[model samples]
Target chain A: MEKQDQILMKKQNKTYVLELIKNMAPISRMQISKNTKMSPTSITRIVGELQEQGFVKETKLVTSGVGRKATLLDVCGDVLFTIGVELDKAVLKIGIVNYVGGMIDLQTYVRNPLESYEETVQNINDKVKNIIEQNAIPVGKIIGLAVGLPGSIDYENGIVRVAEQLRWKDVHLVRDLSKLTSLNVVIDNELKMKIIAENTVGKAKDSKSSILVGIGSGIGSAILLNGEVHRGESNNAGEIGHTVIDPNGNVCSCGKFGCLCTYISEGAILADAKKMKDISSIDEVFVAFRDGESWALNILDRTATYIALAISNLACLYEPECIILSGNLIDKMPEMKQQIEEKCERYMWEPIKKNLHIVHSSLGSQGVVLGAAIQAQNSLFDIN
Target chain B: MEKQDQILMKKQNKTYVLELIKNMAPISRMQISKNTKMSPTSITRIVGELQEQGFVKETKLVTSGVGRKATLLDVCGDVLFTIGVELDKAVLKIGIVNYVGGMIDLQTYVRNPLESYEETVQNINDKVKNIIEQNAIPVGKIIGLAVGLPGSIDYENGIVRVAEQLRWKDVHLVRDLSKLTSLNVVIDNELKMKIIAENTVGKAKDSKSSILVGIGSGIGSAILLNGEVHRGESNNAGEIGHTVIDPNGNVCSCGKFGCLCTYISEGAILADAKKMKDISSIDEVFVAFRDGESWALNILDRTATYIALAISNLACLYEPECIILSGNLIDKMPEMKQQIEEKCERYMWEPIKKNLHIVHSSLGSQGVVLGAAIQAQNSLFDIN
Candidate 1:
């Protein structure tokens, strides 16, 4: 146990130094020692290990205040890679992401909505192999693999408890993937991964805490507090879609009435739009609204109001620095930003709203993949 | 910066040793070192500091595996004291709590609702001074003071941003209290302090994470995630009262429509009861219900449903191990628990609800004061 504690401390110090160099490139080892308050000996030892691992690199020297030349350090972003996979009902996105969360290669594949979890896992294994062989990447450079999907995921056990869209229940994602692949395996909720991407490399890069609200097939949110995912007990903290909005409103797929998702989700909007005209997709509804159809306008206007209410509720609950709008609805219909912000002005509580920013997701289609890869790297990276 | 970091590390190590001794007393220093994986020298140094501070004392000796008698160590609960203040619009509760959260002394005074912040602070100063004089405690033994009240608080700055019940806005609680009291001061939301007490010594003592729901004059919740308050951007994360539950419902005091508090809070229930008959307090409505008044039963039953709904919403959002119901309503009306539980069974989402326990607070009225005092101890206690 004592040895484990020492190892943890060593790893923490090493990660801290690597992150510092990654964030503040061309910084000297003395600067890192000063910033972290680690001894110069400790800094040298950790930096030596990082360099051996091909993570840290010495750049050109800069003259110090006393005219002494000091060598600056930076991280080699391409020295490590992690595989990120986004599993959805109709599509699967796979990518190889570098140490710095940059996507080196990405591929999208159409998935049969009725495919079994086993078949999906097999497909993921095959695709990962293809990506590796095609890129001719050394096996030692790849850290691990992570899959992001929608559902109440038991991240600890890597089980998809229930993903309604994927029609999966109690799927042993990590166990199956581990059996098929040599790399480490991890799985998390899609929104959680999206928030990670936003926090690390996207819109919420400067935020200490943020919430990502996904509003596509279903609505869900993920919270990042002080750089850690606020996974509630059972890793199901941000299932805001199931939160009752109105006791007497429409029944949700979760058997609850007036859940937030039932009113503002893509499926719900399409369903509401079909009541007025023969529309099967959210895009068609927007097209009809663009043509000034009163029913379409009514559906969208009501959707914006409920979206604002959802934001207001989240603000009341989490009070995060920012709430990034994401998923197909926000990503595709960028014009809705103005309406949502306008309604937020009326719906949001005054106190918490003062410092809150309602922003769009900077990562478009790459959020889940990039975030999942970063998560894999985070979980598997070790200083030995 | 380097020296500061070393000091922080040393303090952390000392705190860890002290906490271990407090939790697992009657164990030798060898066992503590084994458990913490700290060196014998480091453990001895920390223990010696704690001993000099009067926090730790040697207990009876026990034979070790090597046949040598080892002296066991334990924490002294009465070595230090902190003042806990629960300030409400109509009442002011002050108490001197010991290190282990035992109430050494307590006092309650009637506070006029129209009193200014300065007047309240002065009253608190006088009351605290009186308690200290009455107890005849040494000045060096006292740690500091902490105040817990309702509504939004900027805890970092010790400012009461807006507490509707107290009609306070932008009131510098810590500054005013500091001007009168010689001790250091801290302040937080009432529910936040209540949950701290619960997490430390009450119903949630064994819980890794818990939520406290205060359902009295208004409804609010405090979340403890891994033993830390999940204070959001403004230390106002759990303001469930302002969360809009119904888009077309009654207006809340915050000018919001259909907030959860507008349905289940004590004031809301009393106002609702008055629709059927003249009612002055919540007790009258319960009396009418006991007498089989249909209107009274209807009102109470609906209140139970919304209370359940509020729990469901919280459960969906937090997925905490347990949600402790407290404040005047839950404490005074134990009979309503069964109804609330039944409604919870019907309202709560299945996946997240399975492991969640809905329990009543055990600390009674001493909760806020004990919590505040402990918080003060946490913030002010130092190992020099």
Candidate 2:
């Protein structure tokens, strides 16, 4: 056969294998034949080829059926790995994940290379190389790289239009990273990653429409509707931090007065905490509040109220199933869960509020990393 | 062939003919054959059957490609009609629409029959009959009936759960309406209809993610994401009007304080306007403002500001291609076009605000009617 013929056959095989895995994973050859509308001989041949490629493995036999016991074909978790990097202004977090979404390695570094976009890209490239070499991981095993940044990203163009934390504007992060590593690179806004994480693994798994609230130094959110992330016209949807909750309260970084983030973010709580005394971090404030510190308690309550208001407004607009609250503040002070839930109940519409669930994120800080890895895997599957 | 086999073939032909009309309307039979992947002989046979059933007709011929002129096979709009009814607490609007989405007749009544759920449904049934009879439309030509109401609707069950305006709880609207009319009845929330309208013919026609703002006596919204209406897990999405924009503002009907609707709804504006002077309608208030009435201007300006804030928040969360302003207020004050766009500019992110186009609804009051008709058509297509 010619090279073109081989390519066509391979493409056809890939499609068949993908459909088989999606529908009948942990299924035997006999079951695949019945389900996939493929002949038993063709199924065996494809399975053999997939096994050789380390994409599928034969598990123990099932004994429930009347016919002969059959070995089940399952996805090989170790066949490939992908790197997921989430770059915030103050810290850079990276995770190496396998095909089944299990994190093989995770690391976080506190560094600010904001003044220069090139330096930041170089730093990420160096770190990725060092991690792979230190682990002695095979280069061929690594599939691709995905990054989530805090800004408006043009996923199609692979450009970061403006990230407030990084103070970068119109940076072609994907092109730079792709050139440095010679691997496919994907980037999107952090909020979109948050939503994707929740949709894939967190509280939003069962929800068709949901909103994931990321309350850290600044507020951001990801809106998932109808089982897909809702990316607005320019891929800048889910930028809820700038919504004005109080028109006369405080000026925001976006030069807006009384934005929601100015009242509910970690920065907001820290600012209020500073009025009483010098509070070093949001974690410290949460700890003090837990210890019955009046000032800290008052500040947390105020922040919770604002957050509740924002959530209620989101509910009214999108009518999502549940709002998953995550980020540095929630991760640090899980005890604030009751306070936030109660406030949402008070603020949201009575009918919608009755049906609403304010749940904490299960994946916590790993949400973005895992989501990025899944996104990269999806791209690979599309290529195949 | 057996009778069943003949029926199945007819159904298949009907579907094929519908698809051909949808894609190649105002097209010749020869063109349809090329587009549908069907043989020219089959296309002719199907077109002949469709013409006999009053579903299609031959129009003028056109010369093309140096070939003989071909007569066009077009949908006969007068052969079938759909009835669309929009029922609110204070008013009822009905329309008769043909296959091409053209309205044959429209009527409005302000009676507030919602005090009794059974009576309201009975009234609708009676009105539907009278309208059909008055127009001398044959009952057999009516394909289906669609109604857009307020509140959360179980589309599958046709149950209305807690429609505040109707003062009804968990009424089996579809079942009840089916008993009154032989035609298939479909019911959904008004916002969902707005979304359907926008997707089918409004500003969202070409864009995948779009938001529709309905500023009537009550403010609400409908969202279209990824080319589908985002109905959340429980069919209660797009309730943006109930979101709390101001914590200390006014108590809303939903028992929330400072919801977006409490500040920006036409009713809210009218309430404020009434306190300043005796006004008969929203149009009167707009007129008063135009005549330099300070109080009216103040109320309208404040209302516009709240609307702008809500739009900004929606932009941040959804980043839609365009946010359409529709419903009663838009019809009353066309000047809101400039006010909303200007205010949105101040609150939205630079990239998003720069590209955002805030436009008045092109469908006007007929939006819900056309939307309902489209909804009925979707049900027909949904038959697997």
Candidate 3:
């Protein structure tokens, strides 16, 4: 009844219409109206406003039954931009991503193994600013920047609760970044960010629910629920590596005994290799295993089985349509794919096994930065 | 532009408004408007129409601002009813539930352990019709019925994929029941239904996301995502029991090795007891443990450890705020609750350990029927 409420209602309707178009890219107004159950007039009005605001644009034409063409509207993918940074133990990656998850500018740099959280933030801030200037990116065009760290992060508050890989604890990452730069900042766990990226533009594009399992120095998994990564009560969900596999077998870095990571992480695999051979890295171990060395084969086979078991467990719990494997181990050891899938099939509940699809992460190393970028865009645009 | 489209939009908005009031319960129109961002006039019109349709009513008056009363709308809880039935091997339960998940009538009956699916369906149909008629429940006032079965069900098609406990496989339960009755039917796993009920009106009420782990003849768990049971790609999402704990352990009922259930299910405990002494049921095992028998205590302690590990793994994956234990084993042996919680706390990642809470299912035996009723109501109403 009130004037202010009517305006709010209009704004809400506009946001809904814009979101609908964004998700259903290259959509016709008729399709939008049908899906939203909105009147054609309302759809037209909202779309017109969106176009005028430079948020949407006419892109293509779809052939209709009558040999006529229906004009399609798409969210202007490059109209807004976001910066994504992935802070790993030995490497740092940055990308400027567009509204549609397109990377505009990207780079990776070697990370100082012993850099303090504050020093790392400062270096990252300088690089991001330099990149923006180099590319002549307009300050107003870029939304907030997002950082993905390898740790249990308080994503909502941008605090890293514990990053065992980075040896960082309770670091107020976003606040630190925000103080050093004008850009607003968002932060989340690296695996969580990777899953979001995969859901947006990779193997999980058609999946409303999926899981991404990362098996690098530390193992972790993240769930994508209806297109958003699930951040549970404390953003520590998907810490699967710490889940016990053999409660009495061996102690994990977290001081827990027989964690899943102890048997399957890249570090774990390397440690296994070092016990009998002069192998220094996972690549050497994988090479030895692929060439049919008995010791290496045994270790790889067991880890592959564990990975499959973990996938089966995740499938049963998350009921995900797709389980994607990422991180260094998966990227390097393509031979283990068949082994893991076979093992997962052997372990999975028969019904879930029938529905589950296991795959390699399509985004791979690019997922973290793109995911962080999209998350930043979401934060600035209130996209959800 | 068209009358049909206008009418469709009006109905959609009406459904939205009614669902808002139903979920918010005892909320004023002003609060609804504020939350939904609808114009007050639109809210009043929708509320008035819903009130006239007997879907909602003014049920409360809250004193506000100096001696004024603000009237609140509530869903007409009894205006619609649903029949909920839980089917297990030895016992069956039926409940007549109202719109707001309140139970009007509840009864339990003995079931033939070796009955055929068709025979079981026939008996249930006959009893359901008789109960409805005996209670003078009008056919029009009641929504379709829902059945909770102990199986991996193809919920969308109402087919039981596998139910090791019930010895069921690929039974067209819904079609068989629907063929015999005028009402449509919906079916899901018993654990999934229980979690829904608990999330709505039991121990999980305070939690937006929670897990209900039921330790009965078969160990099973279900997740509630924002008050709705998460049915994964094939409605077999929370098959945590079948998730492997040991690749070389013992074979489980589901033909898997070292399933979490092999360590914790009532059948497993009974089998363990049998391995030591002549014991027929889990009740005997619990009695032995309570009486300080080391054999029984050892079986229980191992199962409790596995149960705690399973809970810790689930918490890591699902990030559930609360984990609720259910079924007869937990219902009868309340002392195991503390031991399991302690074990889970010991194994959990520290951050999650601080955030997670373990509790017993408050609804206990009543969860299944009530949950099925609410699910049936959801199907008929499109409440989500």
Candidate 4:
């Protein structure tokens, strides 16, 4: 073999060792050798170099029968950090995460005084600056930033193509954010980020396939199949909100009549509740329903039916093991679970209904934020 | 390294070389080394063994400004064969395909006197035996059999979970078929098979994310996302038939009201056309419409509207690059394209509408057959 070829082989082996440490640590050299199909000598040499370079460290020692004890190498969790931002229709959330899936910082910003696209961008930049500064995080230690937006986004181009709730069009997000932070920027749809979050750190920790349904002001979902978030032809694979559930129902903002979102959106429920009386929030409506308010129960039942219908249709289509229900509405009203479960049993395939678990989001409203951070970390490490 | 480790390394290198040949064939050992990042000596040794094993053959040499012109190694095209069966609601079509994707034999069987599950299986087995015997095809060369059925399927366990068209439930297809044929068996939803056909041989040849919509007795769709067929949680990903287009419209067989299938199905069009007079088939309805029959045109328009609604919903959710229209009804009515495109323009996202191409299936009736064959081949080779 040529000298250059030998060097390339060594580099590839180093990458493999690094990836192994990142994924499964603190792991012993013998284990790494077995998993990577590498020689014990190679594993030892790579681990020594990584430890010296501050990328890895010996965390513990383990004894083996009839042999010498071995040291376990672990990736240095503090080597780098990632910042995640979720830009929703009515809220903006930020989170800082470490390499080992630990949350370092979290903050929320309400978008009640909604601004224009440029103004929102400026506000986000300002908040990010203040957070980083107050936390005393070094720019060099921040590996990258990931932003999750509510709408169709071009991941490759880093552009938010169209977000109906945000009323934004063709927003060049990555470029704008990169200029301000001087860090690698990545962006994707909020639902896609939610799937990533669940897969990486939340309920779908070991699940090969799962569905994350976000129900708040509008309904949306993210599909994870074969351990990866599915991004369809135009990066709009999980727009479940647009799926038609009521053919002759109310018209959606997308100009379609009777979309799933039109029936189950927070605004839809509030609008229906307004027909009876004034209700400030979904939480208030749920409280009223608990007190035997006929109008509130009726509205909740209708909303729950629509939610169930959408989930049943999804279950028949994807048959995921679990559907993680997130978003503000779910956080406010947990009693809707029974209604959704009952309707799901009535509508979905029997076998699927038997196995399905309609669980609330572990991350709650902060799901998108944590998901965004995980997304950023994934980009930095190239980990699935 | 130990002898056992060395042997394992050699096996890994051999598998890597085989994958390289499958992806980039008609190339030299030097090219394989470059593509796979394997040692040149490893590539040469694996290529030599592969040639001796009859898996690869040397092709014509290519001129280069090097020490010697290298002979190209290519996969043997006729090393194996597979059987594909399309189990439709009305008829069953079968074909034999070679390793190089060439069809060697084709046959169609109409189900005039449809039998029970046991009887149908026995009949299919008899037909396959006769065809194999008549053609003198070697059983050793036949790798497997794949069947496409129009309904939900559990691809993992090879179970026909629930096929409404065939009235099948919990059928252990692989187990039943393996009893009759020694070869391996694979079964999947018919629409998924069509998408496989398009991805492998038809209009969606270059599209990584594409949709195939079958408009016939009932509506169904197959989605291909991220260069892989998107089989949702339980191998039931593309159930476009049940998407509600009218919440208050006619009740569907699935007990849903105003499903897309209710409005666009051949039965729906025929039922609507019956109001004007006697109509035998969708082909006759299209003929009458082409001859300036106002009632036929109206039926076509309504069907197109429902189909457009479904397509628009799909576009918003999946954003496929192209949508292939196929099935008995679409084959007979080509003029429905213009009306669907026009309606889609108003319903789909503006950017998607600008780039979307709605067209007829290139393989037509042969698509399901070819798709089944491709599915068999995919299983035999473990192709994604």
Candidate 5:
């Protein structure tokens, strides 16, 4: 083998051993060798290197079948940390996340809807500094920062093409934030980030492939397959909001008539409620529905049907193991979940309806924040 | 490195070199080394082995910028052949396909809708024997056999879960066929195979990701991403026919209301036409439309609109680089393609519509056969 080939092989072996130890903690060196088919000398060398770097350590002693004791290896959970930020139209959430995707500390701030891109970047930078100082975290231990927002994100270059909710376009979010804090920054669509969190530690943790549907101000979905996001040609794979379901239905903000979002989105429901009884929020519509008002019942029932239709459509197209429902419409109106699932049973294709796990998001609002931090850690410390 | 690792590395290097030569033909060994970052000795050894195996041969000579002449390598296109079969309700198509996905010979036969699975298998076995004997081809050069049909295929296990058109359920097609002919058999959904052909050599050749929509007696779609079919949890990822578009619309055969297929499929159009006149086929409706019949025009116009709506919905959900329309509804009525494109222009989401290439299938009826043969070749000769 060439010298370069030998070096490459060693690096790969080290990464393999490290990942095995991290994922299968309290595993003996013999167990790693048995699972990986690696030689004992190679495992020992890699584990020693990982221990020297403080990423791994000896955990506990376990008895083998032959009555021999062996030390188990595990990853040091606090060796590295990441900053996750969720940037939305009305809120900015930041969290310090550890190696295991758990938040050490989280803070939420009310964001001005009309804030400029520059002002938002400055505010995020200041908050990040304050949080680090307040926690007294060592600077060297911070891996990077990841921001999740609603937009057509140029993930490779960290550019936001259009954020309808934030009314911002052509913002270089990653470059600006990285420059402000001197930390590596990554960005992705908020829904994509949320699905990653769901797949990692929430409702979709056991699903090999899953879809996360967010039906708030806009109706959108994100597909997670084998731990990777299926971002379509232009990071627009799950833009189901603009899909027309009724030709004669209401006009959507996207200039199409009878779009799926026009029937099921939170804004669309509120608009319908306002037309009926001068309602200002979706909660008022729910209250009226609970009070047995015909107008509210009509609006809510139709919305639930459309939501079901969207779920049916998603199931037909994705056929994922699970479909996770998230966003404001689902989170705030938990009572409507049953209505949507019942309608889904009526609308879904018979073959697909079987064995399909349609569940609500378990992480709720912290999904994006946790997902972004996990993504940041993954980006900074890739084993594959 | 272990002895086994050495052998594995050598095998991988051989496949890499063979693929490089196959994809970039008439390439010199020096250029291969430069592109692959492999030493000249390793490239020479692999190339030598490939030449000995009759898979590759030296072709024309090329001169570098320095005027140094070097012999280029090329694959032997006739080295291996595969049998491709397309099984449908009304017909069966069989072809002998070469290594480069070219059909050496093709034959078609009528199929009974209610034919038993065993009878179909026997028929296919006879056809394969006749084709091979007629060509006077040697048995050793034949790779395998692949069959594409309309249904949910358990591709890994080579079982047909359901073929609604053919009325087949739980048929062990691959096992039975292989047992009869002593050749490896693979099966996949016809649309999935069609899209594979489309991605390989048809309209979607340049598309990174694409969706194929088939509108006929039934409606279905297939997704191709990065050279692999996206078969979902149960090989039903693109079963878009049962997706509910209008809750108050007509009932679909799947017991759903207002399915996309109910408005656009050939049977749907024929059903609507028979309501006004005694028309029994879709071709008659097209003829009447061409002859300027008012009722015919109304039906065809609505069908075209629904076809456009399905395309728009596909575009919204997948955001693929292109969407290819296929099946009898599209192949027989070429004139409607323009009308559908016009409707798609009006209905598509503005952002996704801008760069999307909505095109008709270039392979037409031969797609499934060609793709099946290609898949057979890939399966029998996998080096990765």
Candidate 6:
């Protein structure tokens, strides 16, 4: 136990040093020791191993106030890269991400809606190799690949249990994809990944716990605490969209009636718009609402009310300091932000209202791709 | 930094040793070392500090397997006591709790509803001393006092912010009590303390995160995570009763329409029962339902359905493994347990429901008193 404790402490110190260098590079070992409050001897031992493993390197010395040169340490970011994929039915976006969660290059691939599972895997394989060749990056530099998609994903077993959007069930996502791409693979729900990105580098970076309320293809939420996404017992912790709100209302795909999503989702708004005429998409509803169409305004009013209800429920449950509203619905109807905020004030439990700050997703449509990559980097690099 | 780390580690080991001694008395040092997998030297050092502090004592030797005598340690449980008080408008229950969270002595006092706040404080001051002297316990052994009551309590400031049951606002409870007793005083909501006792020794003993859903005077909830109650930024995290379930329904006292409590709370059930006749209490409604009264049954059905809805929403958002259904509503009508369980199945979001174990509070009415004592012990003894 004594030896084990020492080893654990050493590993923790090493990770802390690595993280410090990642966040505050061009820093000297003395400064790292000062910031970490670790003894110089401990810092030397950890830094020595890091340097030998090519994870850190000595940068050019800079003269201090006393005209004394001090060596600066930097992370070798170019030595590793991760592939983050945002998958959907007809389109998938792939990004080459580095240690700092910055995407080197992003490319979108179009796929046939009727493409078989094997054909999709083969396409991804060919595209990945092409992207690597185009960037002239070594195949060895890619540590792992992570796929973010819609639906229930068994993260631990690497299986897509059910992806309603892709019309896929029981797909061995990691097993098949890792074999084709020849890299380690991880799969997770898109909203979970998006919250991970938001919690790590986006809007919720400073929050201890935060909720990312997604209003896209469907209404749902993802929770992030500390730096890890809260995946409940079955990795389906934040399935609020299916929570029955009006027992006598619309039936959901899950066979439940009056689910919150039925009243506030993009599809729900378009369905209401269809009662007047053939309104094909959410964009038309937004246009009509902007043109002072009373019908569209009523639909939005109902949607905003339910949105506030859902937000209040979430606030009561988690009491997280921040709630990020994202998804296609939020991105398109930015004006609704004020209306939703006002409704929240009405529906919110009084005592807890002042403690919360609800805001729009700062990452916008790019959160999923970046989030997928961030998860891959955190897992593969073990920098957590 | 190294010295400080060592000091911290030593204190942690000391606390761990004390806890082990409390749980496993009459055990040899060698056995403790082996069970903890800690070095013999570390165990010896920690045990020495515990003995010096008079918290632990070396007991009589016992014969070992080889016929050699082995020294054993035991915790002096009665060396310290904590005062636990459960307060309401007209009555207050006080208990002297020991190390095992056992209430050694209990006494209840009735107060004049029309009496001034100072007179009530004077009555409590006299009774506390009377109980201590009758039991012959030294005042020096009383580490601290903790009060549990209904309301939005500012725990840090030890103030009863708003207790509707007592019709009190901005009452400086700890300031008055600490002056009367000359002991440290901590005050918190009754639901918060109940969940603490439940989390530490009751139904949620083995669960990582659990919520206590209270449905007594009103509907509310308290959350426990990793042994700590998650008091939100305003110390009002689990205010689920105020969650708006219907925008078009009845307005709540908080000025919110269709609050969950307005449909499922004990007060709500009695309110509906009054329309058919003059049902003044939840107990009368329960008796009427048991007698096969259709109106009473209908009222219960609606209440159960809404209870299920609130629980489903809670399960979806928190995803905690255990949800302890409590409050006077469950206590008086135990058969409602079956009704609620069945209703939960109907409304629960499919995935999360399977992972949850909804049960009634095992500690029942004694939870608040014991929980208050535990908090006092944890805070004053610095055992946490």
TM-score of each model, in listed order: 0.87, 0.92, 0.84, 0.83, 0.88, 0.90
Give the alpha carbon lDDT tens digit for every residue of B1-384 in model 5. Answer: 999999898888888898899889889998999989999998998888889888899987674677768888888888889999999888899999987777999999999888888899999999999999999889888989999998788999999988878888898998999999899999999988888788778887866788999877678999987767888888999998877777789987777789887887777888889999987778899899989999988888888888888889888888888899998888888888999999998898776887798888878788889989988887887653
DockQ-based class of model 4: acceptable
Interface root-mean-square deviation of model 4 in angstroms is: 2.7
Clashes of each: 0, 5, 1, 8, 0, 0
Q: Which candidate is the best by lDDT?
A: 1
- Candidate 4 residue pairs that clash: A247-B245, A247-B246, A247-B247, A248-B246, A248-B247, A317-B236, A318-B233, A318-B234
DockQ class, candidate 2 = medium
Best of the candidates, TM-score? 2
lDDT for A155 (candidate 2): 92
RMSD of 2: 3.2
Taking the candidates in order, what DockQ does each have? 0.61, 0.62, 0.57, 0.40, 0.61, 0.55
TM-score of chain A of each: 0.92, 0.92, 0.91, 0.93, 0.94, 0.90
Evaluated at residue B224, the lDDT of candidate 6 is 79
- lDDT of each residue in B156-260, candidate 4, tens digit only: 898998887777889998899978887789989888988898998789897877889998877889888766887765677678777556656788877766667
lDDT of 4 by residue, A244-342 (tens): 666567887778777788778778888888888877776778788999899988888888878877777777556678888888777877788878877
Candidate lDDT (C-alpha), each: 0.88, 0.80, 0.84, 0.80, 0.86, 0.83
- In angstroms, give how far residue A300 of model 5 lies from its true place: 2.6
Q: What's model 1's interface RMSD, roughly to a tenth of an angstrom?
A: 1.1
Per-residue lDDT for A374 in model 4? 79
DockQ-best of 1 and 3: 1
For model 4, the DockQ equals 0.40
Between candidates 1 and 6, which one is better according to TM-score? Answer: 6
| TM-score of predicted structure 5, chain A | 0.94
Itemize residue pairs with steric clashes in candidate 3: A1-B41
Greater-lDDT candidate between 4 and 6: 6
